[model samples]
Target: MAHHRVADGKNSLRRRGVSRGLVFMLLAVLLVASGVVVWFQVGDHVGREGDAAAATCVEGPATVAIIADPDIAEGLSAIAKSYAETRPVIRDHCITIAVRPGDAKITLDGLTGNWDPQANGQYPAAWIPQSSVWAADLVTAKPSVVDGTPESLVTSPVVLATSPELGAQLTGKLDWAQLPTLARRDDSLTEFGLRGWGSLRMAMPTGAQSDASALAAQAVAMRITRTTGVLTAADASSKGVAAGIGALTEAAPRSPDGTPVGAATAIADAADAADAKAAPIHAVPITEQRLFQLTKADTTAKLAEVLPSGPTPLADYPFLKLTGDQVPEYAATAVADFFRFAEEPDHLAVLTALGFRGAAPMPPKTATVTFPVTPNPMASPETAAVVDINRLVFGPTS
Candidate 1:
């Protein structure tokens, strides 16, 4: 009986040891499974971190293409070049800007088609044009092209630029009301002069009329002719036109091209000679802002801005982006940054220096004045005619 009880106790001890061993194996399996799960989770987190770093580091330089009239281009390019030197921010990324000059309409037209994801003809990050009206047309055509509404960075008024002597005789000081009286005559002053308006006074001569300068002058002349009873260029030559022509002749010398020489070179040369002449001819330089860094000294000494007697047409410059299948990530970033930066006081001051009025918070309504309708080169002829007719009558200089 004693032997049997000892054997039974030994059997019980062996069963307990087997159960404990099984429990230890199960615990080991569970620990190994938990370690595998933890390893995957940590690996995923590290992979995501690496991807984010690559995205941020791999971005290329940001560039902007500006389409502007030559006059505005000169000023805008200078500003953009200066801005690029500083390397501004775009989505926490450093940006590099490029400015290309061309007709505003033609430049926007080229933005259509397939864009390579990398390299040549890829896509412009941003576009700045001479007129805000052009920007509106672009947005209307393809609303999705740009990320947001176009913004204006600057404002400039179209003015009649004339030789110093002729400028002096026309209004004593430049005045818009007197313009109608100046466009009536058939005299040499009203004729298209090849050498420009400076030829009327042989004392201070300057060269030919620039295409742009001539167009602007014609627009002004047309506005005045429309206001008075003069219809054709011939009607402008009548005796009634004589008084007007005489006034213009007094202020400006007529060129052989039947236009006044208002080119920058001509104006600068005329200004340089103003001090030596018996009658100091002053260039009739007109702009909205009374102050400009380039013209401030001249304003204080020889230059003057002729404020319109009535409401005048205001020029609005627009920045735009063209449509594409996939919007560039960097383009959106650069545009947002530029708009924000342009609105600041310091930046506005730079615009002011360049003969632009800082963009106002409130834009004037389309119906405010009857003169100077914004031209949309892309518009249908019928639509263009309507705009031109409405614009032909009222602005300071059409």
Candidate 2:
């Protein structure tokens, strides 16, 4: 019995030893697997860190805020989206552009001073006002308001827009110089065979109204003074120019509520309504872009746009940067990159698609009727001259 018990004990000891050996092998395998996984994970993280350091991507992404004219805002926003998708890296960080459409007069007013938060919000990092006229206003008030020479992104010519009835009669019949003499005359339109139409009543957008209107007023001053090149501040203050400006303003339709009225509302209203014998306003100076927008928005309503003969003023959409000694290197670099991107032929296509003349100068796709438009930079009146004349034409808003 004792010998049998001893054999069973030996067998039990062997079984125990085998179980211990299997457990040891399993633990060893788990430890090896875990070590391999940990090695790969650490190596991947190190590699990515090395690449980031090499790429110099040291800062958080930068968001660039750009304030653009309401007229050009849609097109500008489209281009801004494309810029972001292209993934531009300025100063070693990804860039995002946020475009906000702003009023030309308010933006001009903001930079010119007397900025009320309720009237003008915080100044944007950069601005694309409707024309250099606003910039000229700044220069007249304060020269250092700009950091550098303003760059024009694209050129839009100002044209007279009227209801079909009036446009049909006036196309190519008169020039900018003829306006002052005719605008206030009771029989001005009747002379053009618009018997019941009263006068050649014209609406000129000024100050807070529109950049195009301001330019048109300057055109009148230039013609009145017989001055070429640019209308000087002296020309604006001259008796002849003031009289011309006043006459032009006198022809504008009176506001029903005794509030400010611009050409945009009148044109839009005419476009929405049927042709009537008594139109609210007869004619207005508008940009090619606006003419396109007015017609395109409602195909049923059409406006007759005529490029008045002689030296016509152009809307130079100038790009300006808010400059100060405090501007950081990154901010300036971002501005430069954005400007270059906007000027690229590929991106300028965006503007041309929207009926604008590109940086390369394309024939206005917006022109329904073909009139020769040779856009010369010299055609733009001096900004300072336009600014002074506007005070005479529109008077002060406040």
Candidate 3:
């Protein structure tokens, strides 16, 4: 009886041991399965870092290429150098920035290979185009080109920069209403005709090509309740526009050599040109951060800026990151990092120094305005239209 009981106990112990072993094996399998799912879900994140490391890990400096417009190249370059200062040390990656300047439309055409991203393939890590309207074209062309969204870094206005005297004669205030009066007053008088701003010694052509000329034409049409003929290159070069700005300039003060004094310089020159109380000859110097820099640097203080009254059309500068199959994941990461650096306060200061208006004062969320419907470059006939003065001065469709 004692022997039979001992045998039973041993059997019970063996059964319990087997059950525990099975549970342990089941737990191990579950852990392995969980790890696999995590790997797949987080794969893109790890892959991006790996790609950045491989591309920028060479013994020499890493290259960050920037394709931008010529007007802002100097300032953009300065900002890039400032970004490279700490980014490389922090990320263990060396950065080299290269800038290429051209019209935004031309730049985009080169990227998508006929406005089709699927066909053209990806090229640069980043592109900072001059106009938001142009950036809108890219977003319409390939919705996913720039991190799947559009981003603008700075804002500036396309203003009719004029001498201070021109600003005063128009309205005592530099508003749109002053344009037609300036235009009509200087009509048909070739020698400092109303079209030329009074031959104010300087010969800045008053035609559509001039920012002020387009503003005048638009203002006149808006005031008269007519659809101003689209600001075509022809209209800009037309005698009407030229004669108007010419007349305005005629009232302007000029140097001994007959060169028109710039707005800031005109102010200082006005002090010398006439009694101290007289207003100086002012150029509607387009109000831009760059203009401010120029005014500070000019010893004569000839250029002066006329701030807009309301709802002025401002230039929007966009910094875009291009992504597609051809562009490696690592390149995208580096490009993204560079963009973040650009938004830093110190970096923005550099941009401001270079005449770029910083993206502040406006709400942070307002950096980019979105469209309800994404434009289809292939479907839209307007995509292929060549950029001309009329399109630029007026509107894309106008």
Best by lDDT: 2
Model 1 segments more than 4 A misplaced: 1-94, 105-123, 133-149, 163-181, 186-304, 325-329, 359-398
- Candidate 2's residue-wise lDDT over 1-398, tens digit each? 45644556655655435577899999999999999999999999999887676456567687776778777778788888988887777677777777788886666667666556565554456788777776777767767667788887777788887776677788868778788777777667666777666666666654443666667777777777888676677787888887877887776665333222345456546642223334566677778766775566454545677777767777777888766543455666777778888899888877766667765545444334333565533465556566676677657545
Q: Point out the higher-scoring one by lDDT: 2 or 3.
A: 2
Clashing pairs in 2: none
RMSD of each: 12.5, 12.7, 11.1
Model 2 / residue 32 / CA error / Å: 45
| Candidate 2: Cα lDDT at 1 | 44
Order the candidates by TM-score, highest first — what do you get?
2, 3, 1
Error of 3 at 22 (Å): 30
| Per-model TM-score on C-alpha atoms | 0.47, 0.76, 0.51
Which of the two candidates, 1 or 2, achieves a greater lDDT against the reference? 2
Cα lDDT computed for each candidate against the true fold: 0.44, 0.69, 0.48
Model 3 residue 230 lDDT score: 33
Predicted candidate 1 versus true structure: per-residue lDDT over 1-398, tens digit per residue: 45644556655665435577899999999999999999999999999987676556445555644345444556556666667766665554566555555554444455543334343344565666554434544554455666665666775554444343444444334334354343333343433332233223321122221222222332344344453322344433434444443344354543333322332224445534433243233333233332133244453223333333322434456666544544466656665665565576765665655556664332221211111332311111122222232222111111
lDDT of candidate 2? Answer: 0.69
The regions of model 2 sitting more than 4 angstroms off are 1-51, 54-56, 112-123, 206-209, 255-277, 297-301, 359-372, 375-378
| Residue 355 in candidate 2, Cα distance off native in Å | 1.7
